[model samples]
Target: MFKDITPNQLFDLKQSKMTIVDVRSPKEFQDATIPGAINMPLFSDEERSVIGTIYKLEGQEAAKDLGLKICAKKLPEYIEAFKQLPQPLTVFCWRGGMRSKTVATVLDLMNIHVTKLSGGIKAYRNWIKEQLDTLPLPELFVLNGCTGSGKTHMLHTLEKEGYPVIELERMASHRGSIFGHIGRKPLNQRTFDLVLGEALLTLKNAPYIVIEGESSRIGKIKIPDRFYQHKEASHQYVIALPIAQRIELILAEYQPEIHHDQFIEAFSIIKRRIHTPVAHRIDEALKNHNYREAIRDLLDYYYDPRYRHTLNYNEEQMTTFKVTSIEDALAKLRAILPALHVF
Candidate 1:
């Protein structure tokens, strides 16, 4: 007989060498799932929909008959696929429902014992939310900077050098700006939470975690209240780069020439916030392919002032570093890492 495991037990099992097989349809798996769980869908989207329709109109018996017929043809393939996976497998579906039950029962009968998640993905999601709500996390070492200051780059470098770091912007697939979504597709809240929970789990015992400072919201995703609270209370490193270097970094990252249409669209959304003449100049520069001038005008008149006005921390509360390049910035940060006891 197969075992049924609760969400908490399954979470602990994640650290062990095991594969989590998601038996939901492809679309459901794609929408949001436990991080690192692989899809082994029990039914195609259309097939699942047909089964649901049958259940609604013709009742349970008819739906089970249809499901059985569908499964019969696919059983051989299922067995072959499960055999190829590593042992000590865990299986789940939407709500520990039919899909996972059928797969688990069949696999058990075949003597390929696999555990079923007690409440499936729904239970896992609830467990994740509960953890995020109540679990204490490591203290944050927030890197604060203006729009083009390469704070994200710093987080990546720190992570590479063995410091515990979380790249929230990267996770969200956004830069947390008006032009943030130009070249990337942002993750929805559910997906963002899934990854965030995974990251928190990985870094729960670190001395402290490094992260770029961000507002509570990044694009369509909101940072969890627990993390946001820690961020607000953390010591901040405010990085300052010369305007020329900042512009170069922004140009390299956004590559307006390659994303010209996206840039144009983003500008249209924020034009009303800029002074009419300045916005006009920016529009003209983009039209003429003068990205440098456009970017400069935006920093001087738009982004810089807005950033200053929204500043949450005073200078006394921050450790400021004015550097000439990213290399210089990294070196400075390295010098202070020991002082922070983050080693």
Candidate 2:
């Protein structure tokens, strides 16, 4: 007889000798699931949708009956699947629902031991929420500066130089500005948090961590409330560069087709930041193919105004470093990053 287990038991077995079988739809598994779990979907996206429609349009009893028919077709395959697994195999659907139990019951009848995650992935999600919602990480040090300061470049430099840096924007396929969407597919919310959690865990054991300054949303996913608070409490630095140096860094970000489209799209994103007349002028410049004017208008009217407006001086420990040229940016970074160069 198979023993049905609670979340705690599943947790322990997962850390040791268990295979976690996620029976959610493929898309659902892609969005999020327990770390190290395999995709053994018991329902396709269409099947799940049909069952849900039945539950809503028909009734629970009818939905369950139809669901049983679907499960019956897959039951023997599921048993064969577990026959090939190592001991302490665990299975779960979205909420430890009937789909998961139906499969577990079959495995039980075959004298194969299986476990069910009580509250299933929902409970695990809540636990992660609890972990990421608290305060005082104290290890955060934010890299702050104007656009084109090469902050992401520096983050890679720092990591290569043997410092831990959380590249949230990279993980989200964003660059953390109105123009952040260039050349990246933003992770769906589930995958974003999963990667974020993994990144945080890696940095937790490090002596220090460097992360770029970004608002809560990297793309669509919000940075955890706790991680934001941690940055607020830690030290800060402004990686300053002269206008000429900034232009060089800025040009590097402009991909001819990709960044151009994104640059044009970004104006709409920050429209509320400028005076209506100024916003209208920028829009006209874009329409007329006046790219230079559009870029200048955006910098003056939007980025500068917004950055200045939101600037704060809390009790953060701050350090300022200025670079007069890209060569200087490289040198300054290299001075602290000899290890990176060697690597």
Candidate 3:
């Protein structure tokens, strides 16, 4: 028998010093998991599948015998890993079931001082969903700007200066654009929520949060309606950069992630809007590695035209700053902080 703690208890304990171990299969761990928990699977993906088949075809007793045999062989490795882990570790599995119990039992016997999560990761996920829906969010301030104005860069700079900022793109692993997935592996919606919730939780007590203005969807993930509603109503500041400078900034930021195929494909998407002839030229330029020209044409003909309406829509309420470079952007941002009172 092993001790088990409720999800609430686990959530509270997370604030303190402790290591959380996830004992689910690797695939499950990768799709979504507790933010800080490490994956220490009791069964590899293939082994879990094999055990599942045995349980379905044979029976529980047969599966148990098989599992025990497999565990016996790997026990030495597991023990060695546990020996190096910080003490007072917490362990969990998909449903606070046998997998986690089996591992926790071993650690306990080794005098590692372990606690098992009651109802497991599933319960923790439920708690996360509830928190996302009901947790009181700090005042959210939107940082609005034309494409490639370096808003994301400014957000990171502000965070480094002790300002409360949340980089949504980083959390979602997508850049919040048509090209968002170019070089990034987008997280599934469940994983997005897990990380977003974790980010929000950390900022719960901040005076306010600075975030980029983005549509509801970022890659495959959808911003929760509640959070999106807050974003819609929050005060916003716009950063302005000259078209040439914007193009240069965009190219520099995406340079490492640029692939000819992907760049051509992205331009193809705007073919119907900007027309095939123009899109064709851009595509050809990208294929030839003329990135600066391609980016310039896309910004001028595609992104700029599409985003122009924002400048006029709420002209009176929005604060706009014209910045020519990163240093200029920071200075302008600092000028607005007094108004935001975040200092």
Q: Against the unseen true structure, what C-alpha lDDT does each candidate score? A: 0.89, 0.72, 0.82
True-structure Cα RMSD, model 1: 2.0
lDDT of 2 by residue, 1-343 (tens): 5556765566557657588889899988887787778878888989989999999999999999988899888878867877998876788888987867877877788888887777778876665565456412536667777777788887887677666778888878777676777667767666666667656654555656678877778767788777876776666667777655565566667653445666667778878778999899988877676756666767777776676566575644766678676556656645543242221
Which candidate gets the maximum lDDT versus the true structure?
A: 1
Q: Is candidate 2 or candidate 3 better by TM-score?
A: 3
Q: Where in model 2 is the C-alpha error above 4 Å?
A: 1-21, 26-40, 56-62, 74-91, 101-118, 134-136, 188-191, 248-251, 254-256, 259-262, 275-293, 314-316, 324-343
Between candidates 1 and 3, the one scoring higher on lDDT is 1
lDDT of 3 by residue, 254-321 (tens): 76244667766766676677867778887778877888877788887887777775445365667777
- How do the residues 177-237 of candidate 1 rate in per-residue lDDT, one tens digit apiece? 9899988988888888878887887677777888998999998889998889789888889
Arrange candidates, best lDDT first. Answer: 1, 3, 2
| Global Cα lDDT for candidate 2 | 0.72
- Cα distance off (Å), candidate 1, residue 318: 1.2
Give each model a TM-score: 0.93, 0.73, 0.92
Could you arrange the candidates by TM-score from highest to lowest?
A: 1, 3, 2
* Residue 210 accuracy (lDDT) in model 2: 73
Superposed Cα deviation of residue 169, candidate 2 (Å): 1.9
